[model samples]
Target: MASRPGAWRNILRRQPSSPRKTSTISHISLPLEIPVEEETLPYYEPEHYYPVHIGEVYESRYQITGKLGYGAYSTSWLCRDLQVLKVSTSLPKFPTATDREPKIYGHIAKINSTHPGQALIREFYDSFDLQGTDGRHRCLVMQPMHMSLLEMMGLNPRPFDLPLLKMTVTRLLIALDFLHAEAGVIHADLKTDNQKSTAPPPKQIDESRIIYKSRKFGRPDKAKGYGLPSLCDLGESRIGATQESNPFVQPHIYRAPEVMLDMPWGSAADIRNLAGLIWDLFEGEHLFGAVFDARGGHDPFKHFALIVALIGEPPSEFVKRSETTGQCFDTNGNWVAHEDEVIPTVSLDNLEKRLFGQEKQLFIQFMRSMLKWMPEERKTAGQLLEDPWLQ
Candidate 1:
């Protein structure tokens, strides 16, 4: 493939394997020649999204059939494990040419327990390195999942019914519990994009009119009902405490307040992301959608302004304790409150009514427990499993 002059190579490098990752796109079939720059993807382009065309074979085994999605660090492909009993699974495993994701998959693949949530966490199969134009790239093999919860919500176009919502939340909570308590891992980014179930096989298409992103028989249809939604994209998954000390850990909307404040955070940050994810599931919109700066670029302060509008100010104690609070909040905890003219800074109580449109006491309580301003005060995944709302 020839490159346009001055085209920036993606950020896919030899990253440390264990990290968090999210932001899902549908199993979209684009013309192999379609310009990525022309299409506005959901997340940062060039950084995460990469080009994978039809009939490209990698590691002399797995064949690239389709693109599931990618994030700030990696692009995922649907592949056929030619070496194994042909299995069709999605491997968002190629975001970084490093050992981190493979390491996390290797860790998860060793579990011998049986639990509903276990099914939700995609099983790791294998990995390999591929020769790319830039350099050797690390690719991971995960049990193929169907569509992301984002896609599923789009398919239904409504909040999940109480039963399905409970089931999904319960399973994901259990999975988080396992990752936090048992495996000693932290899925720094937990959102609908990471929560995926098996998707149906690729549909037939005319090669001339449409781009085909799959093999003729890559693998059989992943089973339904018996399937469980699992987390994918370990590019951001980490073990124990976050080895990196940075403000950015997750997508802006799912980002924790502590993260916004440049304060240290832990696994509870994932819980905060989950709180936003659940709300997005029901409302079909981000609790804190993109906030643009004066230059029309992504703005972090605007996001916090919305957070304060909704959840009210962080505890005064928390503000005084934070290292970066001054950047965002005044002594009284106002962060450019009156400067921005537009965008809803709705309260949590209003958000509950707008999202649920009915009695939302249980759901409200459940979100409050996780979305607390103080990361330490938020419930653990295990403790969340016992939430009366979930019950």
Candidate 2:
């Protein structure tokens, strides 16, 4: 059967061998009639083989403990460093991989040989390929973490307290700053699920049973809880200079308007997303949910309804600018403009009325200001950090 041009090459290169090598293998010849590019290839499924058992060791170094969370392309695990004897037993194994052992070993070796410092930063560990046992072939080794922010959010009975919220947001911003300012990288997917907590010391331990401390740190008030939040999951991360877009960024809720408009966005967009996250922390629900019409797909209009409901319709000038940029707008019934020509429109008083009606609008305004359609008009992370609400 013919396959897509790129698809055929990928398949031919990645074909797996049988478990046992045969001395006398039969050769079967087949004719290629259809063009490779036109052939339909089977969907590529991720290998499910997790080769390394609980106590397995790779390269005689890092030891595997257990699985962490799965990312778009990789699975993290908790592992321990064998070289550090003193802290080795005390420190629980951080998240490390148990799948695709050989490939992971090769990657670690290569990284150690080429970029030793960077490899050290990555904390080399082990993963395995359970081809014979299962069929999966990929794995990863990484630092150990406790509950992710998503887990923490679900675990907390009460909404995030103001100080905790600010602390969390600040830490995230700082992480983003380090990525953008120093590393020249962009964390495309920033969400609660990707934020992890540092692992606490283990208490009771056994071959099969291990006791761990709670990730949550209680606040002065018994009702609230907090933890040190650390950013994780860099699979979608890219160098700042790279111009490609990842297809699987967080949903529209966390997406910046510039991204929604299909415009070229940089690190600033990350700030916008962080702002939305902060709002969610305080509101205890997605800020854009009311405006979003799930049935309409991810159209901005769904959010436009929210804008109208809160800040009123966008101004004609704003609409005109949006139109000039080929943005679409809808005028209730009549066809005022093409979908691409329509721009967001609303009056300021309508916005005030919608947002200020009964509930306090200050925080909402803070978030909206950062979500401006025009990138230049939006507030920066530094500016948002100084906002009175946060203070």
Candidate 3:
């Protein structure tokens, strides 16, 4: 029988009169009848969501208190046990990264380490499958986290102060070192969104669908101390020292030059990615610009031109190593572009306006150490921890 046109939108229940309070749930002062979460997306369907309701319990435990947030493939809810429940969309027979995510956590768990960064990596507490209308949905129980660094950055237009910047960079480097040297994993997608500060939640409702505002994650006063910064989202992570033949990795703007030229990339790619992120956090703007084409898509050639302008051309040996270097450069390892293609005129020194004298020079040196044309030339996460600038 055909399901009703919007049967899946049916709300199982309205708001829970009394939510269990293992943690606090601050309510946002938004409209009572806001739009349904995850309803407007083109790919969204009724069966894709696991049909959660406030006060509903799963696995004979873990009662849902409020909706946390929704992503492309999953919706997170704050639970009664100081846990966030991430229920993934139903999957096909074939396995995907979401399927492997729990196992990746297991791998990290197996590594016995006293590294301070170990605690900085988010880990799933438990995982189980829920039988949904279409297929089984994988649910991960995770510690409640505060706000993403990206969201945090949006709260303040000004760049992060030097103390905050130092703390952020040091913690990230330590976490990366732990993951690379101890866990032997590659966080291929290290960005502001993937790094979150640990914390604490609060939330609306209807019959056809539950209407609620996304809980606000406000920045706490710096006087209270910025919470421990932790890295999350291991679904895209890879478990190897050196990853080869992976054509696609990292966000477009943060993508390393080696990955752009179709060369082998390893943990060093993360160093480069972090360099870009650090720039974004400290400079209050992205370091690289004009990477998007007319259609608003990532233009690799334009990206290369920007890189060339800022960091100078890729070394000849580095150019020869790439499988598809011919697309932008000639056989002689010299850049070849159309008559209209314009290389940027600004250098790093010119673009960086926040610092002066020795401080600026040291900062640029720190960035260059990670943003090298050759992957081998980039410093490891541990080595970067010892950098005088960071100190």
Candidate 4:
């Protein structure tokens, strides 16, 4: 298997292109037996480690292929369905965005899409509980996808083209639309890792490397399709009607103003995240970049300063609504001055001009609609779908 091996760590799944060297890695299927010694020289240890290994069975049904990833409280494993792949029975599904929303798995694929800017959700297959070394963990069996948007962007220095970014965001927005409208769910945590469309960049991948096994993990045949964008990792998702006293939680870059400011968030929170997500997808960076204070504090104030710098100041009324307003800003609606330096504010128009030398009015306007400090002022998923700039 090691054709000419040094250390077989990553599988280089190169995408073949026409005239240039543009390649993508959309899927990962690992062999049953991985031969690296667990005790191989290692200086680092992860905080949370699950005991899932190569060639294990779970729920007496799905065979564990490999570990997809792990989060603070959960682990995602690639499990092969022993039932075998059925073209007619599967009916092409979108894996539910996260393990929390078990019902939303097949719902996305069934929805009729008249909207122009949308992508399919990942298809879900099955789920069961597995007892790990820690405790009982939920194991979701779903269709496999390539690396996340964040992973893909990191693969290439150049940001994604406007068309591709817009298209992918549209698909994301539509997924939110379905979750909010059809399913009445709120994806409290929405970011690049949870959104999948483009595959990670691979090197020197060829046809010989392509393996076709009807019993293989994930949708192996889906390598060369149009690449449907889908939301993932729904462990944080909650039904809209279900009231939550949960604290602020989301990646620092995508954290909405209200969440940082200690305000009540709802479906609007997802919209706010979508704003940051869009900027990240296009510019390959967060609209509100992260920073540190003089005291090395990593709190809402520092995060909020980044927001103010990029999207302009929050409304005074919006500040009044926040319970933790005093934490980040003065009564004048100005961010508390840092002990070290003055934080500067930059509008999207200025950002566009600084980068592209001209104003992107439509793009700016579209972002403004979602970047509002007030959750109510932000566009709903349905409203975002109809935003002029999305087209």
Candidate 5:
């Protein structure tokens, strides 16, 4: 039972593209669908339906302000502390419950049941909830940021400046380090839509329009004249040492090679994803799309063709290792011995011959290392943090 290096291709056989027609389901009840034509478009649709606002207090403290974003099984919300009085003299009105110490039961009780560290988002003043729809919906409270990474990239298709890219990736890596190393969590759903930016830079700070600070504390504060990226959305995030089933991971474009191979994965898979995200920041486009769509459905031959164009063929030893792992392989007996082997003789010069030049080689090497089919072969976040590219 040798593992086939091309097993990935067999597992992702493509189907014909769907006809360009909208489904009949009403938009109000169903999830919002971003049409392919507007795929790169960036504008927040306020009317997007989120979870129901049941007018309930959570953990007898945080008050739900509004919906922030939605994930596979949970919805994110902007919340404020009911116990913390506003600077204004006006007293705050708290919600009343029918049951005595109603705070002891209902939504508030559900909130109190979860751990506090999980509740707070890294760096920012926010936290996440694990309970899904069956339990009281998890609410994440934090300072509001305006746009997502998707929106920012959509607005600026060009590669980000070195400073900005470093800052963004550094903050993202820090958050990921906390999730993986410190909190022992995996944000299965990491994407542009989840990384939000603080409110847009103010056109003018004060009536006088006097000189304002250009940079604050070595980081950009968009309110002053710089853009800061924030990571959000944790519904698909897993915590503790347990491996829970999750079907809400980001599409194939952001998925790591191990995830694509359906192999048992861990925090290293997240490091792979972060690597792809950094590539996206540099390339201003997804890398895996060269293979297939995120939702699946594409010609196998065509997908393989694209892969060949980018990464050449897999090495022979790679194939043998995959087959030994019982990974998905073409059952057809035509190439049985080769089934568990990969032919990695293709050279970088050959790859560059197909794409661009030196830069392309650097990018390909970096991506292929992170996208290795084996988790053990993949680079660690700490290793990537020291890459000369980041410096």
Candidate 6:
């Protein structure tokens, strides 16, 4: 049969049959027509990424099958584990913060928990050091996963169904509870990219670059047995209980008030982060979109102005904790960034769509619990699990 117009070009590669003999048994696919640029190919360098070849066996068990995805730090490959007869993800290594991730995962592993959310967190299966052209690359083995929530949101144009939203929130809260109470950890970054739903086999491989088409998961129906959303990528996670200083963490738009004002932040920051994520996912808009200055740089004062518009001004005591609070708020706790001009006349009550009356009330109340000016004022993950809105 003639090959399809845009189908993958397949080639049989030689694989080692034994210690001495080799066999042309493994098939490798490369895209028939390469695009002007593949996803992370432009950023690929010998020093940064380990050169992965198709049909190559690592640790004498994982056979590189295809490309999965890539971020700024690492590129993931789909591999068939010969010994276990299961598919797994092989992260060659991230150049930055290579040592920190293993330590964080180690801390998470030590906490023995039967909490339902414990299973939802993605942890590395195995790790080893691989010598590459640049240096030793820290390779991580993880379970094969689906595309991320961000990708799913992009693919599906319509609004998220309420049922799916509720279910996702419930699961996320459970996971957060486990991390906070059981693990004494905080997933400081809780964006959609870290949360994944589901992967396809690889399409092609160059000598150094692997080319694969990314797949999009269709919008899930109100079906039972939807796999729990796994929270992956702990590179930015912090030891929650040990954070003594007010460190700048979290994505720009999702920054909690305390984090923005330079106050000591903890797990409550994650709660605020989750509220912002919920707004983005359900409302189809960012609660606090990135505000830029004249030079096209992030103007946090302008960003905080939007935050003030939605949830009233930061409490006086909250402002007192920060030396940098004067930049955004006055001594009287009023927004110093010209609230009349910069702050928009918006509220969560008015901005929220899809729900009405009591449902909206409950949701706004749910949001308020997390979006407080004071960190301690925010509800804990366990407390949020019992929220009527989620129920």
- Global lDDT of each model? 0.60, 0.45, 0.75, 0.55, 0.43, 0.68
- Each candidate: how many clashes? 17, 28, 2, 13, 17, 4
Among these predicted structures, which one has the highest lDDT? 3
| 82-168 per-residue lDDT for model 6 (tens digits) | 221111122345344565565666777666567877787774565555555565555666766656778777877875688889888
Q: Let me know the TM-score candidate 6 reaches against the reference structure.
A: 0.79
Task: Give the clashing residue pairs of candidate 3, or none.
Answer: 25-202, 26-202
Could you tell which candidate, 3 or 4, scores higher by lDDT?
A: 3
In model 5, the runs with Cα more than 4 Å from the true position are 1-67, 79-136, 195-223, 239-248, 290-309, 315-364
So what's the TM-score on candidate 4?
0.68
- Model 2: per-residue lDDT, tens digit, 188-304? 666665523244443322232322322342223445434366665554455554434443455577776546545456776677677667766765666665444446456565554
Question: Distance (Å) between predicted and true CA of 228, model 6?
Answer: 2.3
Tens digits of per-residue lDDT for model 4, 250-323: 66677766666656677887888888887777776667665555665455556666677766667788878755
Per-residue lDDT tens digits for candidate 5, residues 297-350, read 532333333443445544544444334323323332122324433333443344
Stretch of 10 with least lDDT, candidate 3: 1-10
Please provide TM-scores, in order, for all candidate models, with all chains considered together.
0.72, 0.57, 0.84, 0.68, 0.53, 0.79
Which parts of model 3 are misplaced by more than 4 Å? 1-47, 194-212, 221-223
List the candidate numbers ranked by lDDT, top first: 3, 6, 1, 4, 2, 5
Off by over 4 Å in 6: 1-46, 82-96, 195-226, 242-248, 293-296, 339-341
Clashes of 3: 2
> What is the lDDT, from 0 to 100, of the residue 321 in candidate 2?
36
Report the C-alpha lDDT of model 1 over 303-336, residue by residue, as the tens digit: 7777777767787778886767776767776564
- In model 4, the Cα lDDT at residue 20 comes to 17
Query: Which candidate would rank higher by TM-score, 2 or 6?
Result: 6
Which candidate leads in TM-score? 3
Give the range of the ten consecutive residues with the poorest summed lDDT in model 4.
Answer: 83-92
